[model samples]
Target: MSETVPNTTAPGRRSGGRVHRLALAGTLATVLGVSLVNGVTPAGAAEAPLSQSGKATASSSERGDLSAAAAIDGKENTRWSSAFSDPQWLQVDLGASKAIKKIVLKWENAYATAFTIQTSSGGGQWKTIHTTTAGKGGVQTLNVSATGRYVRLNTTRRSSQYGVSLWEFEVYGTGSGTATPRPSATPTTTPTTIPTKPAPTTATPPASGTNLPKGPVPPGAVRVAEFLAECPYTHRLPDDPIVMPGLSGGSHMHSFFGNTSTNADSDIKSLLKGGTTCSPKADLSSYWVPTLYSDDKPVEPTGTTFYYLGEGIKDELMAQTRPLPLGLRIVAGNAKATGVNDPTSSSRWSCLHAGEVGSSKNFVNCPAGKMLESYLDFPHCWNGKDLDSPDHKSHMSYPVNGACPASHPVIVPKLRQVLRYPVSGDPARFRLSSGPGYTMHADFFNAWPEAEMERRVRDCIRPIVKCGAGGTP
Candidate 1:
């Protein structure tokens, strides 16, 4: 159960000698303050991405942070997750008009079942270049000839429960004139050209409870029955007790919180004896996530990861929400998610501030002065027979319609992890040690004293009351 080395292969990146040379030439020209043949690819040179290298803008975003820029960032692990709705559109400006040769769409699981490829030259009106009513999700390469400064994908129908998502939306061709590439204007709100989508559905991974109202106990208040453990950053390591147990440095880098002495070999016994950074002194639980990176340097979280209970299930289930069992390890979110719509993925990324930016299942372009955040809800239903399963997650399950699955009938406190990273500006500068934001995941090793854990669930959570670090109102 402990010595396996997890696979960490990243998607193949596109590269070519001619493309590199072209990109380098472009860079050198920019440094010298000169312009290349507008955007024209030289004779026999392969065409390059001509989207003006800017943050993308879409009709709408799922939440702040998941900006439209992700789709054009050229990283397969990152994607643009839109709000669930029909007639959503994503567009990019090429600085100035260009000769479009090919447009490639790399879709996640939640893909556009029907869409139109639109281009605009100098006018405000969009001109359709291609249309499809039976589009399949995955990688689609379209050959086309068009001259425009803007390209857009207007999705009209979705094939999955989630909104349309794309890992990459690439426009390949040559520049038309001496126009220099510019950063696309990143917007917080949806473009005014289209109607905003409705609120996200339950199918979307739940967002953070940062703005949750705190009520002493007024009637009709938001029934957010929860107790919290705010564990600040403790350390960084290349070990995972749950995934690569006993194999120190066998996994990717991780920023750990709570128990300070955790390592690949750590267990409940060792964690209990270790010191902690949690606000509540009794909590020695170990929590960790893949370390975030900015410009190739490891960045530790400036904010703590709050461990909350009684978050996802119905209020009535609070009474049955038992404290996490000692030594019980659980993982929330999928570190191996290939794209935004990976069914096993449960992580969501958003801007830290309220409505400051859109959210996504991939990396988000959080506005400057704001941090990026992630949310994940751990499975709350447990199989009484086993403390842990062979898969490490099969013993636990998320409730269905406020009821625990029969296969795992015992209800437990739904532990929701909210983690924040100190990063802003271009999301293209960010990447997790695992891959991207969508692959973000956290692991928990419960080591709290049985009595203290029990009291919090019994008094704070069960009664549908919010409790502070002390487990009291």
Candidate 2:
């Protein structure tokens, strides 16, 4: 493994399903479906300080109270503090697209020396609006021209020995909602013309990916209600298409499987056009994990199995289970674990042929000839709206009382990753790119074609019948 730290970072994590949503489109002053800033004339367009009404999130926080929300709460005394690490961020999601005018940063002692300001229109893509390599601490106001629904500060380097901290991060912008009479006026301060709306995200559903032969179920079919795929280890890269999207070389080393072209900029459209290394061939979904190393040498998994099963919920709910949505991104396990017994950690390791050794949160010393194995389970509950969330999680939840929670009503097949490495024995020799074995984590980006995914759900997962890669039981 090339890096020995958590590869991904999610800034402003406090905004991801933890804060109340802003009611921008509802009850706002709109003359003809176009939201107008109150007390502002057409000639002198006023920009709403949108950050106050929006949500803020971050990758990691130094403490629970020192959250991303503090930066956008319009309170200068309060601040957001990140874990002491490089490549952290803080982002705000304006309720709607807006014409970005200016950004103000009220810095504490810990300030970013190198950073980039990025914008996005609720899509998984981002545009760089501003970047700074030489940063002066204290309060700094930046004038920039950009339009986006989200504004993020990607901090690459910190001036202080501690992590980045922001007392107040403000964004001034006008709503992107259509305006009545289509005012051609610009900002009262230097006006920069921008489009009414950003282009719609590219979301063409991909064709079914799989060519497994369809045949009648044998009398002794597995009876597991599982749809499985074998995607062996393919490559190692420092790219995370989910948490670190659009920022190349921003993550720790990762072992990739299934998709051949997954990168920092990969989205559903890009994966659909790439080749797959999976057994079924058609499932181009990308799967990755922090690379494992033993004795300072990388260890690759010889056996990789992804199981989509209807095992967590009752059969009745399984019947209502929907196919994994396209472009869905999920993360499992805690990458920031401090040790094997960290409460946030959720990883399991065992030996393939040494059952007597038992499973553990950290690496286990398997008997001779036994291979080390890792398993991670992803949640089955779906929120049904957003394909991705600010924190990479929070859009999905684990079943409550054997059923999906009301907040996340959509039931989906539970996904579990089982990986078996060829080497085992001394536990002291094993370590993941993230950390110890307890810090093992995994990431999944869904690019499976709708038709193929639905078929697997209908014929196998929903019906509680074990099916092969071709969706036949």
Q: What is the C-alpha RMSD of each candidate to the true structure, in Å?
A: 19.1, 22.1
lDDT of each: 0.65, 0.68
Query: In lDDT terms, which candidate is top?
Result: 2
Which regions of candidate 2 fall more than 4 Å away from where they truly are? 1-222
Global lDDT for candidate 2? 0.68
Q: Candidate 2: lDDT of 365?
A: 94
Error of 1 at 424 (Å): 0.6
Candidate 1 per-residue C-alpha lDDT over 1-473 given as tens digits, one digit per residue, 9 for 90 to 100: 00000001121122124433444564465456553544444454444476525325688766422446556655555456678778799987665788898887877667788999999975688889999999976667788899888899999999865667776788877764432222222111101111122221111222322232222343211123556777889889999887777889888999999999999999778998999999898999999999989999988766564645554355444556666677677777777777887766666776664232556788788767677777666777777555555456766777666667778776667676766677887889989999988888888888889888878777666665545678774
Query: What lDDT is obtained when candidate 1 is compared to the true structure?
Result: 0.65
